[model samples]
Target: MVATIHVPVLVREVLSMLVVRPNGNYLDATFGGGGHTRAILENISESARLLAIDRDPDAIERGKQLAAEDSRVEVVQASFDQIADVSRRNGFEQFDGILFDVGVSSDQLENGRRGFSFQKNGPLDMRMDPTDGKPASEWLNTASVQSIATVLRKFGDERNARLIANAIVRARPLSETQELVELIDRVCKTQEVNKHVATRTFQAIRIHVNDELTQLRQGLRNAFELIGHAGRIAVITFHSLEHRTVRRQFSQWVDSSIPARMPIRGPNKGPMKIVERGLAPKRQETERNPRARSAMLQVVERVQ
Candidate 1:
């Protein structure tokens, strides 16, 4: 099998924001294709340890190979929401830095068997970890029309979510990628320029199947708990939903206000400090990689 080429988005920005220390430990929370993990290892000192985590078994296997080549690297098979537990089990009480490259991996999308892409006719399985959780087809086939429409509207921002959901409900038991794609296309007659008509529906179903938003919210909380004082947290989000979650989390961490009902309160000091506002990929990088066009980077440092 030919190796999937995954160019890590915003490499330069991620590295610069991370501020790698020679002897500091780091965590690559989403070790998709091991692009960010590899870069971290290359830049950090040999004495510094880097733990890479991923939900996909295939990615974990690939990460194991990378770990084999370097004694300083350790790969774990787990979601980012399990970061605190995974880190503690791995002998890391706290990390000097953590990186989250949120969203689907290129390997999952390019490979039809993974079922993350509507461009390919494959099984409608969109699970990050194929071993667990119900597949997208199961959810779509069994979920209520209202539930399906809600997912489409909330996650995908689809304007014709009801129409699409109604069409899907009328045609139950969708098992293939193209079947759902065709159904959405028939119901939603208009298409965005340079984008597929089924893009939003596909995104909505995948998000619902994987529970991505919940995972993201939990992962951010776990990351904040595990990062040491002065340590940095860098997140690269590809969509508005992901970005908004990160933004809100950072804002809460940086807010100095305490609820009036709280009995015990420390000095009005926030636990985190914002490092930068929303940063986008440069024109050159976007031109080279169209996927980078929608990418946004956010950074924060734990102050307490």
Candidate 2:
């Protein structure tokens, strides 16, 4: 079967805000489909070096292929949160541009065995790095009702979090995505219209299984440290939770609200400035890629 390739969203905006540099070091923290990486390469010079990192083995292999084709690219198999170590380990102590495309890819959703899509009947495994961490099924089947409910509420904002959690506990050992989807449908007592009732639950489970939010938060801090003066950090978030995290972090990094006070370190990390508060895909781009509909880009640059 031909796998669906994930088209990068807001390509023009990302390139504009990020690759304003004239041949400088760039990093793609989540090289999902290599679309953004390719776009960056096209905009950069022959002397410029770009590093792409991904936790997914499939993406890493694709990155390796791209690296082979282009000597300017270096592909690494690591989580985005490990940006600091990964960067220094590969001789990239600082960067002119950094991108964090946060969320799952179309390829993962289309592949049933990856267990990220509610429509697919794959095993309930949602770890971005399948080799590491426990599967979603293992957590869902074993976690307490309160724990499950908390994750649903915190990550997915599922209104019926407690109700769904209770139902899941009653129907123990959900091994398949369809099984969980059916359970959520029965509990919600509704059918899919604009969006599936199981969508939020699946997202919550996936996020919890992968510790995504924590990874993103840490990745943001690491990116802030790794970015050079005037270097831009652009983040494309797919969910409201991720949007909030990026916005709050960027705001704190800028700290525009803080009064004139001592230079003691608090939430305000110096040398960062906000470039783009919130940028969404244009109508034409959204039409071509529906996944870009919910995407929001936030950019911040370091200014010494």
Candidate 3:
């Protein structure tokens, strides 16, 4: 028997920000479970077009099934970081709107084969682009202990990162999810055992393997460039790290400054402006979809 899948964190909020011209062009950067994509297509005019992108091949395939009947929706297999290239190649020269539902999907977490969950034991592989990227297992085996600890501390904010890193290093060449979980459990002194200590470690590893934070930075920048005048960009970030990146990037876009200077270029002066402060899901939507509980939606529009 198949279980039901919950739609992602801020569907309604995203729709409110996007879906500008029913006939306008839109892009779904994450395309996880096609929840937002289906809604956008259903509500928009027949002429409205959607370009959905996902690095995970499984997500791309799933989106294909959801969009099979909608000729207006184009599904592409690629990371959201490649937003500019994908949009250009697909002839979406400039978009009316773009939505980024960042981070992992429920499909990946629940599906043990993807190795994203602690509920079901699986391999430690967490590459979103499994075709071209290195898996989490390979990284753990090869990374220095200090590097591991830094990722755990920076990404996961795991308090015992040093100890966890030491434990992981001692257990060299760890293969499965359970092995890492067990190693973390062993090193942790607390007996409460409320949840797996490896949860944060796993999250850190997944973020590193998938290059999620970096992709988000680039994707947002590309999005700012790709949106047409008055076009909107909606981002739904699940966790604190993802939220922080979105917040910082959007904040920079709002104030007309770059958060971090890059050698390639300095801040671009533009007419982009934050239309409003961030919004959260409604009480009803949150109740209906538990995953929506943590979602924070922020919108920005290109102003002339």
Candidate 4:
């Protein structure tokens, strides 16, 4: 088997915060390459069970291999929004700990064929699940300028959203990462510090193609629904929007005295309390895996 490209960011923090109980059931919502999943398993007991899910079929394949090796591990091929169903089907009554390492996985980003980055220059397809949705190229080739601009602005926070959108419209049918990267360079002359010029554009396109934000929202609710009282949820997000969404929802749950709409379909006992926010990776980790530099972990425990 090929080695996993993912290095598992914030490993020490996630293991300490999320795996509060050594033998409790847990869930790893994004089992990319099984880094975090393996850590969870090692940290827990032989009696403990872990449900590992990822929308990417490659990740699922890796997960299945791990499941075959470890009896306590249960692998599921499902998106974040489908996690609850998979968990129920897998026979989890409720999770003692739930974790989400949100955003694109290193497995996807490093695979040139996945088209997540232009460094290797592959197809323009950016769907997390290549089988489920249309490719980014298909959307870019057909979407209106206004729609593209909106996606760039909202998802990428691109300063040159309109200009890039216009350029993309003119350069329709972009089928490769290099094509889009060159176009982005031509239109947006300025680059983000220490980042590629195509970063925002690729991010926006990938997010749109995968319907990531919507799925994240639904997934957060599903996590809440599946967490038992005192159970904690740890979310490691790489994007500003993703971080904000998690913080806001967690804050709402903690602030409200009543349950309000804070569930999926639960006899939700009460609000969720925050355990940590903006927890960063150790300097050693960032030095080893630069990807960990921008990642942050937030944790909240469901209070009954």
Candidate 5:
């Protein structure tokens, strides 16, 4: 078996904010490698309970191993978007703290078979839940040119989305990772650069394949609803769009009143509030884990 490469980002900040109560109930929305979950458990007492969710099968297996000796830990193999359902089924109406480490795990990027990284040669598969979401190869092979362009543009902020989409369409049946990368390289005119030109294209496809933004939005709302008053919810986002979405949603939830559209509509007694401003990892954390460089952590609380 290939070794997994998952290094938790913003570990200290997450532990500091999410594990205040040793016996408190907590939720880890994205249990990538169980790194954050393990850290939280270490900081808590025996009575503390942790409920974690992961969409990846491999990650679920890893979580199983992590929970082998800890009966307090319950690992669920499901998307965090269904947090409300999962929590209720597990007999938890509310939690003391909730944490979300959004975006792909480092392990996913390192695993070439997953086709998440353009740097490696593999198939064009990039489904977080291979059992459900469409693969990148399938989307690229079947999607309309305009739709492809739109996804790349919206999700990756790719400027040459149209050209790239056309090129991808013209070069159909891109089954392998190299074929897609080479084609994108030709279209984006970044072949000379060391970085792969298909990076953004792949990211866009993955985002579309998994409905990541929507899941993130729903997961945030669920966290706000399922966490008790004064309970803190911390989210670590990797990209600008994801970070912006979390920040905006958290700000709305923490200021004035909860949005009407949010499913977790509490009474009009006034809005829940953020305990403090967003927190970024220390320079030392970035130095230790370069992946932490782009991590932005936003924390909110239910003031009511």
Candidate 6:
């Protein structure tokens, strides 16, 4: 078997915050390369069980192989947003802990064919699940300038959203990754130190193509409902958008306010409590894996 080069970011910190329990049942909601799943299996007892879920078919295949080797692991092919349904169908009503390592995985980024890397030339297909949804190229070629600008501003936080969007619309029918990169490089001046000129555009496109933010919101809600009392949920997000969503959701849970709707009506105060302030990678980890630099981990425990 070929080895997976994907090193899970902040593995040690994630494990520490997860507080794996012997014989406990857990869920690895993102199960990218099974790094976190393997660690959990090692730390827990033989009686412990873990349910690994991933939307990517390739990831599911890898997860199935991993599960075949260990009786305690069960791999499911589904998005993390469907956690509640997947777990229910799998006979797990509540999980002792749930973990989400959001954003694109290393495997996706490194594989040029996946079209996630701006440095590598490839087709403009950025869907996490290549089997479905509109490819980035298709959307980029057909989407209006205003729509493209909106995505860049909302998802990528690109300062030159209008300029980049105009350029992209003008250069429609972009079929390759390099084409888009070159266009962005020509249109936007990169002032951010150590960041690529195409970074924001690529990020914006990928997030939009994958419907990531919406999925994350749903996943968080489902995960909270499915966690057992005293169980914890840890999320590692790489960008401001994701981190903001998690922070708001966690705050709502802590404050027991439904937000924009009527206050949570019940004797129950809330199901979640923040375990700690947002945590970032230490100098050592970031030095080893630069990708870990932007990662922010936040943990919350479910309480009655």
TM-score of each: 0.94, 0.93, 0.90, 0.94, 0.92, 0.94
Which scores higher on TM-score, 3 or 6?
6
- Prediction-by-prediction clash tally: 0, 0, 0, 0, 0, 0
**What tens digits encode model 5's per-residue C-alpha lDDT throughout 205-285?**
889988999999999888878989768888988888898898788767654455422434456454555544557789998
> In candidate 1, where is summed lDDT lowest over 10 consecutive residues?
255-264
Residue 46 in model 5: lDDT: 90
Error of 4 at 83 (Å): 1.3
lDDT of 3 by residue, 82-161 (tens): 88998899989999999998888888888877788766888888877778788888889998999999999998889999
- Residues 1-304, candidate 1: write the lDDT tens digits: 2254777899888888795576899999999899898888878887999999999988888899888889999899998778889999999998888999988988889888888898999999999999889999899899998999999999999999999999989998899898988888888877899989988888888888889999999999999888988898999999999999999988888743543224225664688777765899999999998889999999888768
- For 56-155, candidate 6 gives per-residue lDDT tens digits of 8878889988988999988998886788889999988888889999998888888899999999999999999999899999999999999999999999
**Lowest-sum lDDT 10-residue window in model 5:** 255-264
- lDDT tens digits, residues 62-149, model 4? 9989999999999988998898889999999899999999898888999999999878889999888999879888999999999999
* Model 3: ten consecutive residues of lowest lDDT: 258-267
In candidate 1, which residue pairs get closer than 3 Å at backbone N, Cα or C atoms, i.e. clash? none
Worst 10 residues of 4 by lDDT: 257-266
